[model samples]
Target: MSETDTDATATGTPDQRLHPWSWLFVLLQQLRQFIVPLLVLMFAGRGDHDAWPYAEYAEYAPLAGVLALVVVSVLQYFTYRYRIGAEGISIRSGLLQRNLREIPFTRIHNVGVHQSLLHRLFGVAEVRLESAGGNKPEGQMRVLGLQQALALEQLVRHHGSGAATTTGIAERPDGAAPAGQAEGRTLLSMPLGEVVRMGLVSNRGMLVVAAAAGLVAQASPERMMGNWLEQQVRGAAGYAEQLHLGWLGMASAALVLVAVAMAAIRLLSVALALSQYYGFRLIQTQGRLVVERGLFARLRTSVAPRRIQAWYQQETLLHRWFGRRALRIDTATGGGENDPRKLRELAPIATPAACEALFVHLLPGVQWPPAAWQGVPRRCWWRLFASSVPWTVLLVAVLWWHLGPWSLLAALWLPWSAYAAWQQAGRLGYVVDARLLAVRGGWWSRWWRMAELDKVQALQLQRSPLDRLLGTASLWLDTAGAGPLSPPLRIRFLPHAEARALHARLGRVLAARRMRW
Candidate 1:
C-alpha cells in the first residue's frame, strides 16, 4: 500500500522503535534512582572510584555494573517495538522475557506527549498511553520524532473511536484542521495573572520547602537545623539578656527571621508556579480534550471524553476573595504524583464566567449545585448540634477535675461547638439531578464537587443509632475512581424517606447508562 493508504489505515508495515537517545535517557534514569546506593557503596565501604580496600572486587565492580547496564540498554533498544494497526496498538518489549501488550483503541483513554530538555534538543518527544483502569501509564515511547509523535497522538484521538477512521487525519490537507474547528476549540488559557493567582491561592511553595527541609532533617538533623538553629536561638537570648532587652528583644529577632523566611518562600512559590504553568492552554477537538503547557519541560496530554470521572472545584478563603477558582477534572487513567493525565487542570485560576463555560463545556446539561437542593428535616440539625455535646462534655469534665473553678471556662466550648455544628448542618446539602449527584459541603471553606450517577460504583444507605431514632439516614456514594484512602462522598443526615427515594433513583440512573470505569 501507498504511504497515504498505510496512514489512512492506522497501520505501519514495520514496527517502530524509540529514538536512539532513549538509551541515554534510560541510563540517566537508572543512575539517578540508584545514585545514593552507589555513592554509599563507594564512600562508606571503600575509598573513591579510583581506590578501594577490596582491590579485586571493588576495582572491577563499577566496570561490571556499567557493562551490564549498557548490555541491558542495548538489548532493550533492539527488542522494543510497537505496531499500530486498524484495531489498536501493540507493543512488544522485554530483555529477559518476551511480552506482548495489546491495547484496543476503544480501551485507550489518555495519551501524553512529554518534551524534556533532552527531548527538545533532540527534536523528539516521549509519548505515553494509559487506559482507564490503570494506576500508571501502560505504554510509553521514550523518544519519537516530534512530527511522528503528534501524528500518532492525533490518530489515536480522532480514529480511536472510529469517528474518522475512513477519512483519517493523515488524509486531511496539510496537518491540522481549521483554527476554530472541533479539534482546535480553545477552551481555557492560563495567563501570567492567573498563574500568580494560583500561586497566591496555593501552599505548594510551603509544601515544597517543607519537603526539602524534612528530607534534610531526615538525613542529618544536626546538619539541617538542630545545631545551627539552636545556637542562634541561644545567642539571641544571651544578647537580649546582655542588653537588658528581656524576652521582647528575642521575640522580635525570631519574628524578623520568620518574616524573612516567609518572604523568601512566597517568592519561590510564585516563581515555581509561573515556571510550571507559563503557557498553559486547554483545547478540545473531535470529542477529545488536549492540554499543552509548561515552560522548561513542555507537556501535551490528550484526554478522551470517557475517562473523566468527576469535576472538582476548589477555592480557599483567600481565593474566594479574588473571585477566582481552580477547576480540575479527575480521570481514571493514571494516578500518580507525576501523572500528566490524572487530575487535569482545566483552569488554574478561572473567573466565574470562565468556570461556568468550562463546566458546561466539560459536563454539559448537569446543573452545578442544582438550584433545587433539598435540605434535610429540621430535627437533623439538632442531631448535628447534639453530636458535638459529648466531646465538649468530656473536655469540661477533665478541666473540672484538674483546674477546679477554671473548669467553668471549658463549659464555654459547648456553645461554640454547637454553633459550628449548626453552621455545618446549614451549609450541607445535596442535589440529585438526573445525571449528577452534587454534594455541597464545608462551613469555613466551601467545596462543590459532583460525580455522574453512571460513574457511581456503589450506593449505600447508612443510619447511626441516633439517626435510626430520628428516622434519618446518611447516603454514602462510592465513585469508581475513589482511591483507597479517599473518603466516600456522601450527604449526612437526610430523611429516611428521601434517602430511599434517591437510592432508587440512583439505581435507575445506573441502569440507564453503561459503566465505563
Candidate 2:
C-alpha cells in the first residue's frame, strides 16, 4: 500500500490541510518562546510578599496566556492550507488577515524536515522550504504526517532539480525507498565513540556554560551573582587560612579547581554531542548531498554540489590530538546562514585521510591543501605590528592614568603584540589557479576557505591610507550564502599591482562564465 494513502489523499490539484495534531505542535512551539517569562510569573510572588504587587493576577496570567495560545494555534491550524501543483506549492495562511503565497520549485533552494521527540511520538514532522536571500522561510508547515511530509519534500526536490513530473503527487509503496533515502551512497557516518571524541575536541560545553552564565547574570539584576561570587571567595579564603596555605599551595588548589571544572565541562560536551550528532550520516545520491542526524530530534537536509558557493575546512590543536578535522560549506539556501537547519557540516568529525578523501571526491580537479601557497609580503608583518600600536598605546594610557607605576606592565604588550603580528603575517597565504582559489591563515587554529573561480559573485580591491603608503592592497571575493562564522575569502597585504592584476583576471573570468547557484 502507498504510504500517502494512509492519512493524506492526493487529488489532481486539491488543497491540503496540515496534520490533525498540528495545533498541539504549534502550541508547543509558541510556548517555547514564552517559557522563561511564564516560569518567572509562576514563581513571582512565592518568595516574598512584596516581590510583586499584582501577585493575585500573576498567578492566573500564565494559565490565561496558555489558553489564548491554544486558541491561536487552533485558528492557525484550521486556517492554513496548501495546494500542490506541478510547478510549485501555494500556501494560504493567517488568522486575522489572510495571506496567499506562491513559492515556485525553482526558487526553493533548501527543503528541511525536522522531527522532534514529540513529533516522532505522533509520527509527524515539521517542514521548511527556504529560498535564496530571505529574512524568513518561504514556506513553513508546522506539522505533517511523516509520509506526507516526505512526499512533499520529494515532490519539491524533483521539481527543483528540473525533473519532469506528470503529477504533483508523490506516491511510494511500502517496499519502495523513502523520500531522502533514494539509493544514496554513504560517505560518512559517526558511531558513538567518534561522537564522544568530537565532543571532547569541541568547545560546545564551554559555550553552553558561558550562555548559562550570561542568563544568570541577566536574571540577577540586583547583584545576586556578585554577592554569591563574593561569598564563595570568602569561603575559599577562610578554608585556605585554616589550612595555612602558602602561595604554592594556593596555586596548586587553583589548578585543581580549574581541572575539575574542565572535566565537568567535557562531560557536558559529550552529552550534548551525543544528543546532537547521534546517528549522523552523510550521503551522496542523485547528484545531491544528503545529511541526516540528531538523537531526540531528527533532521534531514540536502544540497546540490552546484548550489555550494564556498567551502571551509578547519583543524584546531585539539582536533590534531583527536586526529580529526571539520568540513563545512556555504550553500545558496536562505532564511539565515546561522540557521541550525542549514546543512553546513559535511564532515563534522573525520580523520585527516577521510577529509582529504572528501576533498578529492567533492572537488574534482582542484588541489587539496594547495602544494604551493603564495605568502604576503615580508613587510606585511611590520604593517600588522604598526596597526596594533594604537591599541597598545591606548591600553597603556588608560592604565597609567589609573595605576601610575603599575602601568609599566601594560607597556609589555607591544613586544608581545608585535611577535603575534609577525606570526600571523608569516602564516597568511593564498593560492589562485584557473579553476579554484584558496586562502588560509592562522597561528594556532588553522582554516582554509576556497571556492571555484566560477562561483565568485563579486570581486573587490581595497587600499587603506596605510596600504597606500606601504604599497599594498587587499583582495576580497564574495560568494552567495556566506555565513558569519566562516571567515570571508580575502587575501590581505598583497602587492598593489598583483592585487589589481588578480582582481582584473578574476573579474574577466566571472564575466565570461555563467554562474550557478
Candidate 3:
C-alpha cells in the first residue's frame, strides 16, 4: 500500500541522495555539534602556551576545523542511502558499523517538509518522517526535488487509497521532479502586516539572552558576570573621580544599560519573528492539516485532523491590545516538528474571529462560544486572596530587610496581586453540555477549551485541604493527549456537590461514547 511506481528495484526502490546543497547542510550540522569540543581541542592542543597566553598554532585552528568539517560532510554524503517503496522506507548508513533501518509508513504519523534558503535556491526540499511513539524522527531525507518530496508524501499518505500525487509520479530520479514547491490548497495565511505585528509581540529577545547567558555560564565561572559588572562599574568611575562622581556615574551606567537592553530585546524580537514566521499558512486537506511556515527555514508539517486530541486559544496582553489571539491543537499521536506542545502556535497570531473559524474547521458539528458558563464560588476569590497576600507580604518583608524604606514599594505588589487574583477568578468557569465540556480561564487573556467526552481519558474530582476548608473542589479532565502549555481541562474552585454531579455526567458520557484514535 505504499506509494511506489512500476519502476522497480529489489533493494526497495533505488537509492536517493539529498540535493547537492545537502553537503552544506551536513557541514553546518557537523560544525555546530562539534564546535565546543573543537574549541576545547584547539585550546588544549596549545600544548602548554604559558609564555603568550595563547597557542602558537591558534592561527591555523579555524582552518583545521573547516577542513575537518569538509571531510565529515564528504563521508556523510557518500555513506547516506535511502529507498522509498510501497510499504515503507529503508535507510542504510554509518561508515564503520554499516547501520540499516526499515521504517513502515504505518508507524509514521507525521511528514514534515522543510526548505532552508539553500534548498529553496536549488528548488529542493527536505522530508522528515516522524512517529508519535518516539522523540526522534524515524528517518529524514536531507534534500529532494520539491515535486519528488510531495510525490513521496502522497505515496505514503494514499498507499491504502491507491491515489496518485498531483503529477501521478510516485517516484522520480533524484532531483528530476519538475521545478515546483509542493503546496496544498491554502486554508489560511497571515497577511504580512499581521506577521509584522506578531513579530513585535514575540519574545525572542529574552530567549536569545537566556541562551547566551547559559552558554556563558557553561563556559565560565558563575561569578564571572558579577565580577565583570563590578569591574565595569569601577572602570566607569575613574580613579581620580571615584568618590566625587561614583553615584552619578553608576546611575548613568544603569540607565544606559537598561536602555540598551530594551532596544536590543525589541530589535531581536521583531527581526527573529520576521525571519522565522514569514509566509505562514495553514492548509486543510482530506486527511491532513498542513501547516507551512518559516522564512529562512521554511517548514511544512502535515497532521491528521482526527489526530487532534484537544485545542485551546489564548491572547497575550500585547496581542490582546491589537485583538489578536494564538490557537493550538494537541494530538495523541504527537511528535515531530509539529508536536503541538513545542509549537503550540498553530495560529501564531490572528484575530479572535479567525481563531473561532479555525475552531469550527477543526471541530465541526460541535457547539462553540459555549452556551453557558457558571463561574467558581465566591470563596474561590477568598482562596485567591489568602494564597496571594501572604506571598506578597513575605516578599515585601524580604525587600524591606534588604533595602530599608525603599522596600515599602514592594508592598505595592499586594494590591496588584489581589487585583490580578480577582481578574483570574472572574475568568475561571466551567461548562458542561451534551457532547462537549469546556473550561474558561486565564490571566492576561481569557482562554476557553473544549473536548468531546470521547476524547477524555479520565476525570477526577478531589478536594484539597484549602478546598475542603472553603467547601470547594477541583475538577480535572485527563484527555488522551497533552497540550503545549496546559493539559486537558482543569477547573479549580467548583462547589463540592456541583463537581460531583459534573464528574458523574462526564463519566457516563465517556462510557457511552466510542472513542477515536
Give the lDDT of residue 506 in candidate 1.
Answer: 82
Tell me the number of clashing residue pairs for each predicted model.
2, 0, 1
lDDT, candidate 3, at 462? 83
Residue 162, candidate 1: how far off, in angstroms? Answer: 2.6
lDDT of 1 by residue, 47-108 (tens): 55446445546645655666677777777888788777777777877765667777778777
Tell me the alpha-carbon RMSD of every candidate: 5.5, 5.3, 5.5
Candidate 2: global Cα-lDDT? 0.83
Candidate 1, 327: how far from true, in Å? 1.5
lDDT of predicted model 3: 0.72
Residue 99 of model 3: what lDDT? 70
For candidate 2, write residues 1-517 as lDDT tens digits.
0111122234356677888999999999899998988888777635565566765566787788899999999999898888776667778787667677777777888888999998999999999988777667788898988888867776766665666363535344321224444667899999999999999998999999999999999988788999999999899988998999988898899899999999999999999999889999998876678799999999988877888899898989899888888999998887576577888999999998898789779888877767889998766787778878998788888989889989889889889888888888888999988899999887667888989988888889999998898788999889998988898899999999999998898887887786433
Q: Which candidate gets the maximum lDDT versus the true structure?
A: 2
TM-score of each: 0.83, 0.86, 0.81
Q: Pick the TM-score winner.
A: 2
Residue 328's lDDT in candidate 2: 90
Clashes of 3: 1
